[model samples]
Target: MDPRDWLARNTFHHSAFQDLRRLVAEKERQGLRLSLCIPTLNEEKTIGKEIMLLRAELVSRYPLFDEIAVIDSGSSDRTREVAAAFGADVYESADILPETGTRRGKGENLWKAIYQLAGDIIVYLDADIKNIRPHFAYGLVGPLIERPEVRYVKAFYDRPLAGAGGTRPSGGGRVTEILIRPLFSLFFPDLAALIQPLSGEYAVRRETLERLSFPIGYGVETAHLMDVYRAHGLEAFAQTDLDRRVHRNQSTGDLGRMAFGILQTFLSRLRPGGGAEALPELHAMLRQFQARDNAYELVEHHIVEEERPPMIDLPAYRQRRGLPP
Candidate 1:
């Protein structure tokens, strides 16, 4: 069966499992050690609340997670301070492994977290989630903890758009449902089943996670969904509805830039004619002329691909362990 059919039959909403207490019990019975990871960049306003709520309800109250950590992309704001104040272990992506060199983006933080944190299951949540709640973490982690067959869980929600005037009750993420979804439907129909394929919240088994390569930028979530599906098929995935998420709105220009980066990453993977194709040489910084003291200043940045080799090619990989080379 196709992924949409699989999602229709197997996908679940957080509302379906509101009883977090039951979910906790099942986690213990399975001897699962859960961890919550939030990737942030200038999220001081919301990170504090997110950590407080999850730590109080999911950690202190129910003992659901073994650790709650915030992996940041060098936020100059009080994001790291605020998260630490709320009792979360906050670490800078650059500090995680100084040897590897740091890259700027959400994927960089997440990739480092996998190496820094220890847990049987890792639940990655976005730092800017305003309507933060315990379910945001538990809802996504619950499925993987309960079902051994389920390897990954993606989060989707009712998003309310924020504008200069106010907030829109309905439409949000114009680029997603309109552009990305149609693209997926045309080429990767099975992937289209992922309601919010770009959603920043998700959970995955440590085994599955260590095997996948992370794209350290806007393309992380998309790359994850595509990579995991290619390796494990539709049955290995699940999704949960996390209600509404309110956050700062992105301008058309910003969204356009994001879409462009995602497209480049997506097409690189989808292209068929490939035989040691030369990898694209990516540039990180752009020079723009600004009226600053009547002089133009040049900014420097290092943009790197940090490409993740396919897991199937690894001899130590679970899927390839016993197969003859």
Candidate 2:
């Protein structure tokens, strides 16, 4: 059967398993352990409420998760304090596994969380989600725990994007619909079924996660999908529709930067051997100032973005496929 048909048959919605009690019991019977991880950065406004609700309703009340941890990217605000106050095991990304020198990114926090928390399965939830609910965790984790074949479960939000006029009822960020999806379609078509390709919410098996190398930045999500798909194939992926996820609306400038980073990461994989069409030269230069004695020197760092080859184009892979290089 084609991969799309497989996804249509296997893909699920969060509402499909609303009975958390049953889901928890099913997991216990199978002896599956789960962990909840939230990677934060100056998310004080929403962090407290998220930690409290998830821990209180899911961890403390239903014992749905084995551990709930908040891995942070050194926030200037009281993000850590708020999360901790709400009973979350908060740890700075830099503090965990100090040997690996900390970096400021969501992936850095998540990567650190793997080393700090212990669980057979890990469910990552974004801290900025405002309409936070237990379903966010239970829904994403349910499929993986219930079905051993499902190694990775991605959460798809049902929110209507502003000005989209419901044409795109199931909305995702600009990068997701435009760049990520098209790239995946051209290369790893099987992965195109993931509705929210850039969604921060997801659940994955510990073994699968430990074996993969995280990009440690915006590339993390893209890297995860590509890496996991390579290792486990399309059958291992599942997307669940989680009703709206309310979060801070990013400014266009911020979104552009995000899209640029993701594009660089994706293209780096799709390049090499003249793979994919040549893209227009994109610029990413930053202006900075250097302090010298009592004076300051204005400087500019010209970030010349380039790309590398994807694994599919390697000479070894071509040889294995009996294709002429």
Candidate 3:
């Protein structure tokens, strides 16, 4: 399909799905179940409002999300407490699949959510959004509930870099502009059409998610788009315009770390039929320099990009979901 045609047909604005009642009716008619998963890590400052707003609007008021859950990465702060207080079913990442062991990253929580949450359709969101609104949830979910051809809905928006007093209208997603987009333009031209390929907000069907692997790091979102597009093609994917998204800011150094992790994920997909295993396992240690007293010191930061297998292949998960062996 032509990029322009795909953008015109698959891309949508939030207003198109503003009628909550009609969307709910379509969901019920299809006998679909919905789950909202917020992957968190030390987000006490904003977790509470994120949960309260989404729960009140999507879960209680509209009945769009049957359950709202927070899958955390063992936060030292009050993130879990605040989320639980706001009526969210909070689970520590370590506790979800104890037998399989655990790794820490936003992707870990997202991967485990497939097992922990009961929704047939899982909508994953980041926990640190200062401007938490219904559109973030509904916009992603609307496309799937309305169009059967659409298996995944990703959120794209005018990302305003948030700060203490206000926000810069543009300038966030340093890693995407610097690394992922240019890379995509070269290899995966069709995927470059995605406004925010690394956006954390998306809703995916159980069948679509169960077949893909999850990278437990910055690479997960990018990997998902590449993997899903490979298996299902452009026809199965859709993107929504959420107007604007305001989230916490990260420094260039932090973005460098993120870019490193995402690079490994992207390279793994490049190998002919490689898809991660096709390339040698990437190293977790990222070496950077710290300057002090006009002297440079080498600092090796361990940033492992561990991946979880497709949920459908696990016996325990299959049994829990009552699927045949």
Give lDDT per model, in order: 0.77, 0.78, 0.87
Q: Is candidate 2 or candidate 3 better by lDDT?
A: 3
- Highest-lDDT candidate: 3
- Per-residue C-alpha lDDT of model 3 across residues 182-231, encoded as one tens digit per residue: 98888788988888888889999999998889999989998998899899
Off by over 4 Å in 3: 159-172, 272-284
Task: Output the lDDT of residue 273, model 3.
Answer: 65
Give all candidate RMSDs, comma-separated. 6.0, 8.3, 4.1
lDDT of 1: 0.77
Residue pairs clashing, model 3:
none
Candidate 1 accuracy as TM-score:
0.81
Off by over 4 Å in 2: 159-171, 271-325
Candidate 2 lDDT, 223-273, residue by residue in tens: 788778777788888888787888888875566556666766677656654
Superior candidate under lDDT, 1 versus 3: 3
Candidate 1: how many backbone clashes? 0
* TM-score per model over all chains: 0.81, 0.82, 0.92
Query: How well is each residue in 188-306 modelled by candidate 1, as lDDT tens digits?
Result: 78888777888778898988887788777767777777778888888889988787878778886566667766766676667544232565644554333335797877643333445
